[model samples]
Target: MFGLGAYRRWLRSDRVRLGRWGERRARAFLRRRGYRIIARNWRCPAGEVDLVAADPSGPIAFVEVKTRRDEHWAPGQQAVHERKQQHLARVAQWFARRYGLKDRSLRFDVIVVVVPETGRVEVRHYPSAFRPPC
Candidate 1:
């Protein structure tokens, strides 16, 4: 029993480490894709945005990154529940108004990072994934 508990704890720790590593990789991937990273791990009273970036197309992108070892429950995109979406949108608005970006075009994006068993990172960027509720 003790051995099993220890193994379980070890597994949990490994998962967290992998998730953090995947987030780092995802940030790098976005930067390489021509997105100018404006903020990382940004926090507001509304909520948190994992990353905020800008594209040449004039849209200030609010990005949420989900990292997992595999797609066990569903794709990482599914993790952004409606409540979460609402909070993100509110936070994005706060971010924009706070920085006088109200006139700028805005978009919500999601990036999913899957770390395979072989330790290869797979990144998927979903542009304009959700819109702010009216």
Candidate 2:
């Protein structure tokens, strides 16, 4: 019974809610694996990063979280394409400069969360998934 605009808005809000839930799950998963969460939903002029965490013995991680339902066609991580990587790289640089972490090692990570309406939730982590262009 909803109009086109209303349906689009509802879908967008639903996606946002799902994304936030996935981020929370990803945070818990990372904490269980000994990664210290530094920030959530960090945003700047370049773009936004879903989560930023520090590995116990490795580089700081700029995590991109992709959340989906079912994911029968394509995995959520696939959504983080080249252009998105470049965008995150820029945001990471800005974050590092602002936080005085320029000299420290940095890494890009992708966390794919699949939440099925009638099945168990799934999470896949990809560490150092991509490198920024020089």
Candidate 3:
């Protein structure tokens, strides 16, 4: 029998693996669309931003990736609620300041990856997902 703590650890590790896989898919999707990947899993005092990319002749994109096994519960993008957006915004602000990108245009994006049992994966990208509340 597995102890509660061990089960929790296993679950956490599984989720981490899923997230990493999803981020890879997201990166490929962005690359195919002409976005230059700047960073992956970038972190700051505020929080973590999954992927940072420079769009071709466009604003820098701060991406948040959500991975799920299925969409029965809800679409992965829906998981990025208001509080999550705020967290991402804070992280983006910190990253921008650190990289001297304050003067450059920036936007938030969400990438949702759904991996189902059928061996097919779905990726949905939302550009300009939301604006940070002032």
TM-score, per-candidate, Cα-based: 0.86, 0.95, 0.95
Clashes of 1: 0
**How many steric overlaps does candidate 3 have?**
0
> Per-prediction RMSD in angstroms?
2.5, 1.1, 1.0
| lDDT (10s digit) by residue, model 1, range 74-133 | 999999888888889999989998999978999998899987688877899999988766
lDDT (Cα, 0-100) at 30 in candidate 2? 98
Candidate 1 residue 70 C-alpha distance from true site, Å: 0.6
User: Which regions of candidate 3 fall more than 4 Å away from where they truly are?
Assistant: none
Scored by lDDT, the top model is: 3
User: Candidates ranked by lDDT, best first?
Assistant: 3, 2, 1
Quote the positional error of residue 77 for candidate 1 in Å.
0.6
**What is the model-wide C-alpha lDDT for candidate 2?**
0.93
